[model samples]
Target: MIDDIMSSIFESGIRGRYSFETFVLNLLKEHIAKQDKPFSTNEKNQKLGDGYAEFGFDRFTGPTIVDIKGKASKLTLISAAFGLSARLERACADIENLSNYIIVFGSRVSLEQRKLFDIQLAAKKVSVNKNVNVILWGLDDLDKLATKHKKKTKEIVDNIFSLRLEDAINKSTTDWISERDDLLLKLKSLYKDGQFSLFLGAGVSSSANMPNWEDLLNSLYVKYINNEFSDEGLIDESKISILADWLSSVNDTSTLMVARYLRKALLNGSSEDALFTDQITESLYSNIGDKANDGSPLLTSIVAMCLPKRRGAKVKSIVTYNFDDLLERQLEKSKIDYKCIFSEGVINSPDELPVYHVHGFLPKEKDSFDSIDRSTLVFSEEGYHYIYTNAYHWTNLVQLNSLRDSSCLMIGLSMTDPNLRRLLDISARSTETIKHYAFLRRLTANRILDKNHEEGRVVIEEEVISGLLKRHHTLSEELMKDLGVKVVWYEDHKDLPGILDSIVD
Candidate 1:
């Protein structure tokens, strides 16, 4: 019997023109109306009720009124509900017998949106009649009603569910398009003015086959275990840094030794890694090495994009947490003169682009090509602590001056990096108006979509994507308040080059 009814619904075809509210009203009349005292819709009540109009209430049983709405945008639905509340308040003032009021939506409501609806409804009731009972019915409640009452109504329920999902996706896509346009405008203005300093993080060097912070630390720990320690029991999977520190103590060597091993490993494994090395001469008379001229395409493109906008003016300073010389090499190849400042008491030339290596840079000399100076590089927990404490140090002073004077554009950074957190902590105490911008990738639900979610999935549902976006937006707001950095989100890294082109071209 149920199969026959579903077959008929399929044959009839659910057209967009069909009124979902009228269909639901008929279903209520069949299942809810008493046989002797028969409930009816507003259309039927027109002839029997007192010479009053029946426009707002779709269905009613005596003094109880029910309002039904089809799938709609949140703003449209909320506005309609507010209008209904005002009408109800005016009606209750005239009609003392009206008591029960139920509002039903043929779509889903988010938990936060539901709470807002309840608060508004309660306020409306307090203004009307304290004794009046108001009930809100979402898609879940309608599904339960279909299951409990009649099997034939299931076809209508399924159609409404599909329509609601479509409505949600359309709304989210429209909102995202509007936001992307606004962000593009802001980026263009900032780039044209050259008021921002670039803050490069580890992600910028990953394209050159450089190991990330974790991988670099883990590589050092493995080398330490092999060369210095025989027992692997000292390895703490949660804290790779602690193990590296312990290995340095046991070997009676500085943590800089571990850093050099990781750098050598990175250089030996990939030819691309050589592009990030510092300039070195074999002898006083010998020519500079090929590494000095070679530039990473990633860094070169970034420099090319920003350099043209300066129009003979000095480009904004570029500060990096990376120890590599990629930015310096790229700037030199572009014929844009830049001052490479690493130590304290060095006066910067206002005519040249200032490239500050805040963490430290690899030292290079004609005779020291095969050897790296450990004292120049900052690595390990102790090195970081020393740099942070010594305010007069060249690197520390340069960073403090940049944060105080320039608006920063942070790139290739992860939100969870400890260095970024520490920078924010320092910026928080500043009395100057410090504005910063960061480029972040948008969160997607693809990671959470597994085989279990593939049954009816054509695409990820809007609700899942919306939740991820909301979570990131909340975090962005917190970062804005605490760090004074406004995040501009991109859908993918591939989109970054085009965005940069738009800003400077």
Candidate 2:
């Protein structure tokens, strides 16, 4: 019977499965109503109602509970335990007592399991008093229940098409805006101190059309395998991914690999005696204080660094995991006087320099043949060790520490990447004066399916938006308390490019 229901689900698609669940719930509600029993709504209410599936009774018998199990093959035993725990917690908190339930959904509940559940109930392991009743239900039980309550079941089936699943998903569950606002204010305050440094991870580059280190290496492999590299066999995808993963947002390995890879892939060879060495030598002299092009702003988010210049306010530094020169480009475009440093040999320390490229740039060799052998550019484990182990390497841990002691503005970073997460933790611990602000992007679930309507004014139901705020918004608060890091969640990245500049300008 379970197999038959699952088969029907597979054949009917997602909508069909949802319809079946809805029909079952409605049938249960109708039956309870017919019995004319008192149904206890139990929600004197605060926040989201009881976590279990809603159940109704004929009269005010108190919270008619329904233990709902939404099943897909992906639902694991661990998830089941978590779900049950959540419902139990909600029940004890809101209703002040457990209630009767009608368990439904999932093929896992066989007859044997049902008998065990019954036994558990008898033993008080599963009970309304404990808020654990309405044990698992099998497909066979649902089929039987459908047969027993045929009239009520048919009404639900007939009205299934009109049911709004979207409404359920969009239901509001939490109030988390205060948390979000607190984070943003802290971020705003942190950036004002101007002593911190930034460590951008792949999350930052997500908007810039650049791939993460792992993806970049994967692309390199693809290019190499197809004759892009001289020793294509030497390039291992797994090894590259490992190296990329191991390097933190602010690590010696990061610069080494980037510089090495860029030299090899972009400059055609190693940087030793490379043609770009001369260009580096010249850009040092002639363009020492040249402004960047308006089109390609580097040192972006510089506005985020600006604060009312006091006599002793410290200058901020930037450490990017990115391969592009956009940050420097922005600084230059803004005509901000600052030293420019990269992982490569070029290090400008004219005192007022604000940005540091932890990862070096591609060689500037004018002549293709004279360029550093591209392979010599950093991208591998050996390269990461070489430049970092050396004390004189550009933007080493020391420099990063120096910058980190000040307040930092982190933009375009995902909180999940291990590298950036480590940097945030480390920097927060080491820097006494360092507070950090991160500009995070928020994604809204679109209700309208039309591609054209995706960009238009689509309402994100209040409930749905609130629920998201509850879960993801906590990141902002936790970071503040734990590391003194402040993160502002923004609906659009394009709107606040000058979070950095707003302070400095």
Q: How much does each candidate deviate from the true structure in C-alpha RMSD? A: 18.2, 16.5
List runs of model 2 lying over 4 Å from the truth.
1-192, 200-222, 225-292, 295-314, 343-350, 363-378, 381-396, 416-420, 427-434, 447-469, 472-484, 498-505
List lDDT for all candidates, in order: 0.55, 0.47
Which window of ten consecutive residues has the lowest lDDT sum in model 2? 289-298
Residues 1-505, candidate 1: write the lDDT tens digits: 3333323332221222123443455456545542433444433222222112222233443365666544434563565456665666655766566766666655565677667765655654545455555666666665555665665475445564343333333233325546666766876676667766788877776655555655555555554444333455554555555676665556454445555554555345555433323311111112224554454555655787547443654247888887666666677677877776665545468777777777766633413322233224455444676776666777766666666677677778775655556656576455312367677777656644653376755666768776766655554544453465667677777676676666665
The deviation in Å at residue 273 for candidate 2 is 12
Clashing pairs in 1: 344-394
